[model samples]
Target: MPVLNPDIARAFDEIADLLEIEDANPFRVRAYRTAARLVLGLSSDLKTMVEAGEDLTELPGIGEDLAKKIIEIVTTGHCSFLEKLEKQTPPALTELLKVPGLGPKRVKALWHELDVETVDQLTRAAREGRIRSVPGFGEKTEARILEALQAQIAAVPRFPIAVAAPYAAALVRYLQNVPGVRRVVVAGSFRRGRDTVGDLDILATVAADSPIMERFTAYEDVAEVFSQGTTRATVILRNKLQVDLRAVDESAYGAALHYFTGSKSHNIAIRRMGQDMGLKVNEYGLFRGKERIAGDTEESVYAAVGLPYIEPELRENRGEIQAARAGHLPKLVAMGDLRGDLHAHSKASDGHHSMRDMAAAARAAGLEYLAITEHSRHLTIAHGLDPVRLRRQMDEIDALNTELDGITLLKGIEVDILEDGSLDLPDSILSDLELVVAAVHYRFDLPRGKQTARILKAMDSPHFTILAHPSGRLIGSREPMDVDMPRIIRHARERGCFLEINAQPERLDLVDIHARTAKEEGVLLAVNSDAHSIHDFDNLRFGLQQAQRGWLEMKDVLNTRTLKELRPLLAATMSR
Candidate 1:
């Protein structure tokens, strides 16, 4: 036996897998999902509770019986129930669970009738007009499947938000280094922290007489040039990624920045404002009464319009222009105000560092504290463990906590919320943990009502503290699971669950508009890095920028709390 600890959430996923197979009770399923999420966020071990024979009811949604199961897994490698469930179902179905709009029902249909079991097999069937014959599937649905397949093939692989973040930084780096380029920067949805960016947008200023355009087209990275012009260049680099670089004279830089760094709606509003002011706006320069005033930097452009510079998150034309004009712009949160980090990973699961190393890195970066939110049992591919491992990890965390002088390390699990609304682990294991970050993993396309009920049920647990990246959007890769955002925000507020502003470039799930709406509705937020490596810390600044654009403040975030204060918040949430 593998000595599974009841507290280790790694096995929670196995239970979720079992539930998906049995098509278990949605709310009960979400309990396991919640447990998985809660465990990843907590600093404690399930084995400790198992050893103490504790009840999971204190952890929320977890009763004494379920807690016993968690202990069973920790001391033994397998649970009899999960093992029995697995015997009746092919584990391979789990791999097919992620296709958009395709749920377990559809997967079962293709499996039982068509004997299709893989993406390639599904693709072939769709191409051959076989999928429509499956019950509940139509010609249109098959066509949609083919389209998604082709899109999947033609599209860039899903780069985690963390991976894409650096490309923007790299582009900026080059622009800053280029001669005559004085104010090079990244602008557009990427600047605003949209989950995915189309092509890179860079804005810069140069002396009117400078050969910046010529220098750019001939730059070392240039491979196949799409277009070469005086103001902009569109080129496909050796890596096959398209990059659009735009240049402007110093006098027109500011207006151009505002124009290019647009969510389109914000730009239209600005243009209207400019027209009212006897001016015009474009990616070139601002024309005011046929003559331009200040247009070199973003600062001058917003200032000219009688407004503070708008953050990128608010640049989506979502009342930001009116707010700026009315002088009702909410005070934006700053990067400096963030005092802690709420999510991170380590070698204990799929992360790259040790617990001590991750904590030390957080401390070195001047963070007040951080959470060691590793993957729970449901993420077996990521090496999610059972309760025994979770308990041992807690011991390591406790020891490290004592070693730190000022920085406090938190126990947190990035638990997987099963399709049925249950969490990955049992309740007995959850009550003693500090933080729970409930997340969605499988069955993303359930009916909206079902999905909503699923998450809401997870939140019923007092142990549930934060809703982590609720939408599960991987920018440029997938759309958010269908759910009513307003209602979701409202629920979080009522339940005291903090909505996350995930700092991953691709998964800045709660951007300004969402964050602002959340803030306006009294939702507490914690801007988290979801950092998997030490270098991922840089992504925090960008995430915070988007949070500021949402008009969040230090007080709205959990990471801003000192350890002493944060402990109470966690305690209170558990008690609730």
Candidate 2:
């Protein structure tokens, strides 16, 4: 089996987690965590590079020691260091670290003091009122742990789109290279642009003698082949992602794609329409009383039912069919529609790249403008800038704007929204920047009313332009804050401020439903990369996916406007 980048990254992360739990050297633990992030963020395939004899140590944050481990995992699919660490610390203890309020120190306390090794053990202790007696855990913390444990138990495992992308793209590319294979498309939530996917449903059309199923089952990343047939196969990747592949002939390709690219409710609704038209629609083909009609093209499939082609992102059965019938479906915003990204960071903060490098990358990505929104001073862990440092960065941006050719850098700060709903920086400093992206980096467990009111109060400030990662969610890791989203959207509408659909895969906040709500409330949304490094710009595609699912039109996205148009809109948010 081939070790993918994510597979290696997971191993490194697990090692870091176990090390931290063991109270090992802080720097050593950080090195492993950083190495894991570096691996995960690379745009290229680490395993392929290792196979090709590339110097793995040349990669940032990867030392000679880590490089050897990378080669070990790539060559043998296991790391001895991680294996040893798992033996020293219970591997299940890592799950306890995922509980919201449980940090490494607290997890250590639970392990040594309470003998809690897993979430179940921790939950049992918490329920028995034993957790509160631990060193740092109070009654409130125990209750929160119990609640988090229950929520985790009830939630289905879903992979973030970014985590699934490498596997999907690799599989598609691999299948496309197979002799006689005509088309390979990943359907299901992935194609529909959902933030998280349960699994990949891959559809392909190939010649009868293609042996596609056999090829798929033999792929380097396949950990196990659940089943295999001439036309269909199910396999799990090494990273634990299940992929189901189905092959059809060209005649049924479109119908098969439509059937597989489904929101189940949407498919049921469309099939009902087919029944009304005296026809039947399925993976085979569309038929009218035993006579094959349309199935060669998705457009033809829609036309057979007297409807226009609906974009897959809009096929959520959320008034999409009705909108299509009325010809009111939005012209969804595409990747090229974005003119700039408004949230990013640089070396002055916790970002890995320099400002100029980030700007050059944005330009390379075809963006006309980019904002450097470094964290404000309150976020000291990021070495966030004070007013003095911020002013200096602003000057740097101004100078670079003059020297740069195509891309212009905007001066901005991701100011923290304090516990009392106040801005982190003074208006005197904030007013000097091109944009003020307010975020809630702390106090995530605030009650819904308080959190909503806190955000609204921050928006009341004259300088607040956008709400960064409006929900503060980290996919499977963190739950979305309990704020009332509709109220926040309405407030943004009234305040003339914008909400962010953060592109970071882990925090695809202002998710599809909230983005749609903002659009319906006549509020524009900004789909920003929130990039900390050049590679992070790629995250914008995920943000675009979320926006597309929200039925966002080009006009509904704030950053899609030219710099001239965007300037006045952002300025308008500050006038009040």
State each model's CA lDDT, in order.
0.73, 0.90
The alpha-carbon root-mean-square deviation between model 1 and the true structure, to one decimal in Å, is 12.9
Clashes of each: 48, 0
After superposition on all C-alphas, the RMSD of every candidate to the true structure, in Å, is 12.9, 2.0
10 residues in a row with least lDDT, candidate 1: 1-10
What are the per-residue Cα lDDT tens digits for candidate 2 across 345-453? 9879978788999999999999999999999999997889999999999999998888999999998999999999999999999988889999999999899999999
Tens digit of lDDT per residue, candidate 1, span 1-576?
A: 222122244357556755765677866666676565445333344656666876655553357766677767666645677667667776666556556657667888888889987788888999999999988999999998888877777865433323344445556766676677777777776677655556667777776666767766675556788998888888764434567888777777777777887888778877777778887777666767667776777887877767788777677777777778788876667777777888888867766567777777777777888888888899886677567787777778898888888778887788888877888877666666788887887777788898888888888876798888878776544688887778889988888778898886667778567888898888888888887666566668767876877778777776777778778877777777
TM-score of each: 0.72, 0.95
Stretches of candidate 2 exceeding 4 Å from the true structure: 25-31, 51-68, 123-133, 138-144
